[model samples]
Target chain A: MKLLPWDYGVRNLLRAPGRTALGAGGVALVTALLVTAAAFVRGMNGSLAETGGLRNVILLGAGSEDSVERSEVKAGVAGIVAASVPGIEERLGVPYVSPEINVALVVNVDGQERQASFRGVTDAAYLVHPQVRIVEGRAPRAGELLVGRFAAARLDVPDERLAVGRSVDIDGRPWTIAGRFEAPGTVLDAEIWCDAQELRVATRRETLSGIVLTLADDAQTDDLDLFTKQRLDLELVALPERGYYARLHDFLAPVRAMVWTTALLVAGAALLGGIDTMHASFAARIRELATLRALGFANGAIALSLVQEALLTAALGALVGAACVLPLDGLAVRVSMGAFGLRVDGTALALGLGAACGVGLLGSLPAAWRCLRMELVAALRAD
Target chain B: MSALVECRGLTRVYHKGDQEIRPLDELDLDVDEGTFTALMGPSGSGKTTLLNLVAGIDRATSGTLRVEGVELGALSNTELARWRAHTIGYVFQLYHLVPVLTAYENVELPLLLRDDTRRERHRKVAAALELVGLADRHDHFPRQLSGGQEQRVALARAIVTDPRIIVADEPTGDLDAAAADAILDLLGALRRELGKTLLMVTHDPRAAAHADRVIHLEKGRIVAAAAATS
Candidate 1:
């Protein structure tokens, strides 16, 4: 008699439970890997962000985002900008700006010698950017400097090695060991910080390398962009803190997107494989469908039943895929952003689940349609 | 006579690439209600074509054909399918039973198109199976049954929804003599006991002996008609 529409399709799917399981599993696995790639990208972007609201606008004298550290501004220019620009953020009525000299220095740590960019700042540096926390020892006197936590560990600089009275020779200048600070595993944690005036005299660098700025939270917003753009000093560059990270993402996005895109492409291939699997599943049972049609099932009802089977398979795959990617939750990966380890986060899981569901659903359409369009007599004849 | 199945100048052609082969050449035929008839012809003489046209499985190339007073040739393919489901029952030479289903489920298939309740369908299917002497074998699959039992189950499938006309394309063609006897007897019994109109195509002399009348065809033309069996 005229039975329920989807009953046959569901039963048919259940008949070969092993095949369904295999297809769903394949889809879930590919989806999880793609999500992991997305998560890695998000973690990298999060690492570069400056949460302390400092204006190390790396006023690049030239070059693109990837080459920001290489750009150098004359130390004298920072003094000129401070005098010329009004309303820079301040603390205790001091203008919230620092004329800093920066350079990358190589040092041996745990047998690996690597470049560590050192930003020589004035005592006013802490006033401009407050996220830096001294984790051990006291602030350095004029001839000394502080190491970021990650920088200290990477260089294998021990407490004995970093005692406030000791010193290490760099470019023939004896740099005394001072304090060590941590900046929550951010880009700042990979660099060394010191007093800029002393560093300038010691390094024989006459011009400041960069100007760090901090604007008051109550400062004007509408004219900031216009004012920054109008500066006419040797091609001055001004960028917002958020705008800076956003640019960082844009520069880093291609590599990240390529990784995820490869995953997505692989997921697409897996989905097509799933569709073929389901189609093969349907094709194997032509006689079964003919028998259903002969029993008086409407063509649409028969088709709908097959589609239901496919969608169920896809949903199962998505759930499995999501769970598979969950363990990548807060994984720490060491990548150089000047020199620290960045940890990847949860966005990869979301992307993995989305790809799993999308591919699973889309792949099912053709298989379901092929199953439903079976002609009654021809199907019966196949018997 | 006014008939349940009428073929007036029915002609059908089969095309093989560029060649047209006429299978049924403007033949006329009639089958009365509650009568069992047998059609005998050589392989290419078109006995199967006549049954297909009269049952709405195919349309005649030209000429009027009607089943249960409905003109089948004029209806579209889609409509013809609906009419066939409601008006005709077909039995194949191979006893085409869906391998996945039990005998009871196979018989109940045609009723799936009807508006019967679950209980009503079960009742009808049970009655049909009982009529075929297979009430005890309802749960058995086709592969588990003998040739006679399989064809009987096919008969149950054909008549399950109570279609007015039953067409059998070589119903006993593959059976042993004893099994063939049982099937022919069942078809004869359906005619006498249930008042079913059965048009069967067969080459078996014993199967034709159970028919109320037999028509012989040669090269797509009716040569002789006999009523000795009825």
Candidate 2:
């Protein structure tokens, strides 16, 4: 009556020295793989969700909702739209609309084709989106550029990484890493920032890559879309910050689903492997179980004990696997998003932990079921 | 007065494809409190089948069985299980001691079904082990023990719950004469010292000689009943 299902199962699993260890290791390996896959999916989707909201609108090449990089809007368009807009949100007595430009440059950093997105922004762009903060040195001067903390890591920029006055050449021109900033886990954390006009000229295809605007106190997000749709001279798209990320998440939804599905499928195999180990262990101890039954244990008690042992082993394996994936949290790595670099974040860690629990429970089921389903008389003599 | 074990007209049948066979036919048996009885027969003579039915481990094809006043034939699987745990303790020919468990753990397994504290369970396991003369070997794994020690551990496990009846099937089948005698002597002591009713199935005459009475079964019916003279 005092014995728990988990405790009994664990004891039974330990009955075989070699087989129990093998089952646990199998569960751990599969769990780790599951966590890692979930991490990647969460990392990518999270990075995408962090960028492009109503604060920013890409006036793409008419049909391209996919990127602002290929889009163009004249500097004159920003001024006209700002003045004509009746309900744009204002901050510090200035309209919170800023024009921006972007380019993905393949920099030869220590002999590798490292892909980095270099963004050019007007001073007011900081007001439109307020999350950015300079952590080291100062903001880029008109003549210099700034690199994010993660970008600094990827380029092996040293202890002087992203330090003021440190320089990295892009296309034979030295762009000084004038300052360092941290916007942890956002896609912006992997991009280089510089003066809009300079980048506009250097990468020159720009009328303006996109415009970002804040909502007026009285104006809701829906008004922006309605206004854009009603305009005859221009075609536009507008979405709220939450809505923008949701779209990005939807685009990458398959990756997330696959993370779970792959884990489940692989865990199915791992569960079978665990069952094999458990079966072998129980097979050898059948007589012992029968003897226990003979000693007055109810059949329910005996079956429960075996199931408990299997679950405990699997839960331990999951804990081990979660520990294995913990170190990958926020590691400096990049993936492509309209040629921009994206960062892994806290969301990835959560997904990894979730995957660990899933592997533990799902993988433990078959073995536990087999244990519980056994006939007491047969199981007792299994050895 | 309630008999610790009882069976009446117990008929157990076996079918092979379409061929029906009878293992136990119209058998009746009863063992009162503190009595030790040995049931003997050749293979296929339903000695083991009778033991199984009386122990509530198998269904009698047709008959009435009552162990401790609870009709075995009237209980469902779940109830039968409860009955088995509280009323009967079993010893198999193979000893069947779980290899992973220490002697104490093996003995404590039965108490898992009882409402007992860890202290109570430990006390019971210790006492059972002591009773079997293996208190010092309480932590030894089954593999670490000799055949006789293992059987004794099995015996300790059977009695730990203090069940009304101890049902043993070929309890000494694998032992030599000396080991077999030691086991029978233990059974004799169990009956005299603890007043635990004992029902054993065996082929060994020496083992049977330790019982207070002997019943001969042939083709599933009791053929003769003889008082123990040894």
Candidate 3:
């Protein structure tokens, strides 16, 4: 059957500017909320997923495999593993083994105390985790500290406050900010790093938290496992770096679920409001709809016209919502684990727009059915 | 001549919470081709209901309604709508012009149902508006027009499709005396000049006087039939 002219639906939206604005604005807010929730989930998952090196393994105390911060290996374990493991990668005769200490410390920044992730590392960390790149200044020396790009966000401080030459008090002693590093899309971007020997001396730690070792291309993880098993007296466990991060992601599944549930509930309420607005709009046009039917237009044609009107309104809303969200791309968001940037990427945008259109299509159905189901003669008689 | 519209034992029933109301009960009538007929009756007399059934906008609960040799009762709703597009032009008392559409666009609505080209549609719409003496006001919306002018636009919409018959329900019911007279004169001109069959329902004798024949109804049955004095 023939449909109504496209301009018919377009012009109807202009009949009541206030109502149209209300409907469009509701859809816009829902779209923006959905985009933000998507960005949060994506950013969090991405940060965790990108942190682990595929060819690396972690050697930590067997009982503390869940959290490296709680894991303790002997301070000499890095050298022992590099010598015992046959497949440890070597560059210019130096083994790719990093003895690291992962700790959470309360630090005073600009007179404000904040809990921050602190990693004590040797130079081998750059060899194993290639994603890390120092963008400015140099690696931390003797009593200095290296800050990650997102460290300021995690510490709730301004970027200028963490620049090189600034000092933060750790263990009641001030450590100079010597450099800045970036590990994009990784949780490490929100941690502070310092020389392991100095950190051990300052914190009075007797053991290293863990040892991270990269394997050569021909090497298998089975080799590391075999070495760990043979050296059981060391009380060490060999775990793939990727598997550790994956477990961490699974541990945070409930947070993601709560995020989605909350977003869905709010979006659902907005959708209902949109439906009510459309119902009111269409109900006021019952007589006109019936007149079209009486003039030989089919119910399907009229319904299509109504849907077209809804889609146009929703598209306008989606455009506005997307514009509002574009500037938020890569915006830093702080969580308990660390800080990750809100990723308003293409997938997030697609989901937001898809939901807006879905609202438009679904919101119009009840109203269209109610208006079109009326008896033509009675509808013509309606005011 | 054979009747263009024939209704035999036509009945329509409505139910409201266990109460059955019969608006038209087994009414029989015939409206000849190329003639203007007016149905006159009181408020629940089924005059408008019969007009609606003839226009194919409403259905009879039982019995037969034939327009141009097609049994309207036997057709499906979709089929009836298609048939209505080709066979009938309905004019409502309120004019019922789509508020968003200009007079030209309103008149062009029914023709869009057919496969007419844009030029062809424009040609017919322009002629219809010109015939109704609103050619100069083609771009004016319904709100921009006076009551008589709006009804004329509705009339223009009714005839734009060039259907075989036009059914008008109280076409002058909402108009002032002078406007009502002008609409009646135009209705008369449609039948006289175009040879188009007209079926109209009106409570006003002055409106009925424009018809070639007037049928009086009470309690769903035709009480009297007479030639118009005019």
Candidate 4:
């Protein structure tokens, strides 16, 4: 069937500037909220997913498998695992074993106290986790701290407070920030790293939080499991690093669900408001619609024209929303696991635009149906 | 003359909370081709109903309505709309010019239904505007035009598709005397010059005087038929 002129729909939007702006502004707000929620979920999930090394294994205390922060491996387990596990990956004859401690400590930065995630590691961590790169200065020695790029966001402080040569007070003692490191898209990007020996002394802890070791290309996780089982007296459990992070991801499923549920509720409300707005807008044009029908345009054609108007408004809103969201990319957001940047990636953008179009299409239906359902004679008589 | 609009026992029933109201009750009428006829009646009479039935914009609850030899009641909604696009041009009492479109675009609306290129549509639109004596006001929107000019643009829209019959409902009801006379003269010109079969519903005797024949209705049935003197 033939359609109405495209300019007809476009011109109708300009007829009532205030109503059009209000409708578009509502849609823009919804689109922005949807994109931000999508970005939040993507960033959180991505941080956990990207943090794990495919061939690395974590040896945690048997009962503490759920959380490395609570896990306490015997301090000597890293050396024992290196000697017993035949397929351990080694570089320059030094096995890739990082005995690490993970803790959440209250640190003072620029006179403000904040809780920050701290990981104690040796040089072996760089060998096992290849994604980390020291972008500034050098690794932290004793009485010094290596700050992640997102450490400031995680600490809720200014970036300059975490910069090299600045001091962060730990356990009431000032530790110089020696350097900065970046592990993009990973949870490690939000942590402050120091010497494992120093952290042990600072906390007076006798056990390591966990031992992370990389396996050779030919090695399977079964080799590490075998070693852990044979040395059961050590009370160690072998788990793939990826599997650990996956468990953490599953543990946070409720948080993701809450985020999605909240976003959907708000979007649903916005959709309803949009429909109401469109209904009023179309109701005012019932006679004009009927006049078109009287001129031999079918109801379907008229309805399509209304949809075109709505889609145009929604497209404008989507552009504004997308522009508003662009600056949020790579901006850090802190969670209990540390911090991750809001990923305004292509996938998130697609979802935002798809939702806007969906709003436009679905929002116009009830109004169109209401306006078109009237008998042509009655509609023409309507005031 | 052959009958262009034939109505046999035409009826229209409306229901309001268990009450059945028949606007046109078993009415029979015939409108000949190339003739101008006006329907006159008081409020609640089915003059406008009959006009709508002939224009194929409303369906009869019962009975047959044939416009230009096509059985309107037998056709589906889509077919009826298509038939209306090809055969009928409707003029509303309010002129009903789409407010957002310019005079030229308002007149171009009916032709958009056909498979015409932009240049072809522009040609038809220009000719229609010129015929209505508003070619210079083509760029002005309905709000920018006077009531008479808007009615003329509406007339241009009605005839843009060159339909065989034009159905007008109180075409001069909302205009002043001078404006109403201009519209009536255009309505007469449509019948005399273009040979269009014109069926108009009007409340004014002066407007009815322009028709070749006048049919008066009361309580949904034609009560009198007379030839116009003017």
Best by lDDT: 3
Q: What is the TM-score of each candidate against the true structure?
A: 0.70, 0.86, 0.97, 0.96
* Shift of residue B96 alpha carbon in model 4, Å: 0.8
Candidate 3 lDDT over residue span A1-383, tens digit each = 89999989999999998998888888899889899999999999999888989898988899998999999999888888888889889999999999999998999987789999999999999999899999999999998999999999999999999999999998789999999999988999999999999988988989999999999998999988888898898999988888888889999899999988988998899889988999899999999999888888999999999999998999899889888988998888988988988889999999999999999999998889988998888888788
- Would candidate 2 be rated incorrect, acceptable, medium or high by CAPRI criteria? acceptable
> Against the true structure, whose DockQ is highest?
4
Per-residue lDDT of model 1, residues B1-230, tens digit only: 68998888889887889999898998998889998889998888889888877877666889999877789878875577678779888888888776657899888777777788889999999998998899999999887999889999999999988888899999999999888888888888888888999999999877888888999987778988888453
Badly placed stretches (over 4 Å) of model 1 are: A1-4, A14-67, A71-109, A112-218, A222-236, A260-281, A287-300, A316-323, A332-379, B101-108, B126-154, B172-189, B228-230
Candidate 4 per-residue lDDT, tens place, A63-174, comes to: 9999999999889888888888898899889999999999999998767889989999999999988989999989999999999999999988888878899898987999
Clashing pairs in 3: none
Q: Which stretches of candidate 3 lie over 4 Å from their true place?
A: none
A1-383, model 1: which lDDT tens digit per residue? 23433544555556778998987788677866776676666656665665436443334453433444555666667666666666667666687676666677775443455566688888667766677888877677787778775665445455356455566666655676678887764666756877877777766767666566776665553344454467655555666655665676677777777877787788778978988997888788776666555444555555666667776776677678767666755444545454344333445566666677667567766776776565444565673
Listing candidates in order, what is each one's chain A TM-score? 0.71, 0.83, 0.97, 0.97
Fnat of each candidate: 0.23, 0.41, 0.75, 0.84
Candidate 4: list runs displaced more than 4 Å: A110-112
Docking quality class, candidate 4: high
- Candidates' lDDT values, in order? 0.72, 0.72, 0.92, 0.91
Give stretches of model 2 more than 4 Å off: A1-7, A52-64, A81-94, A106-115, A150-172, A216-248, A254-261, A293-299, A338-383, B1-4, B16-21, B116-126, B176-178
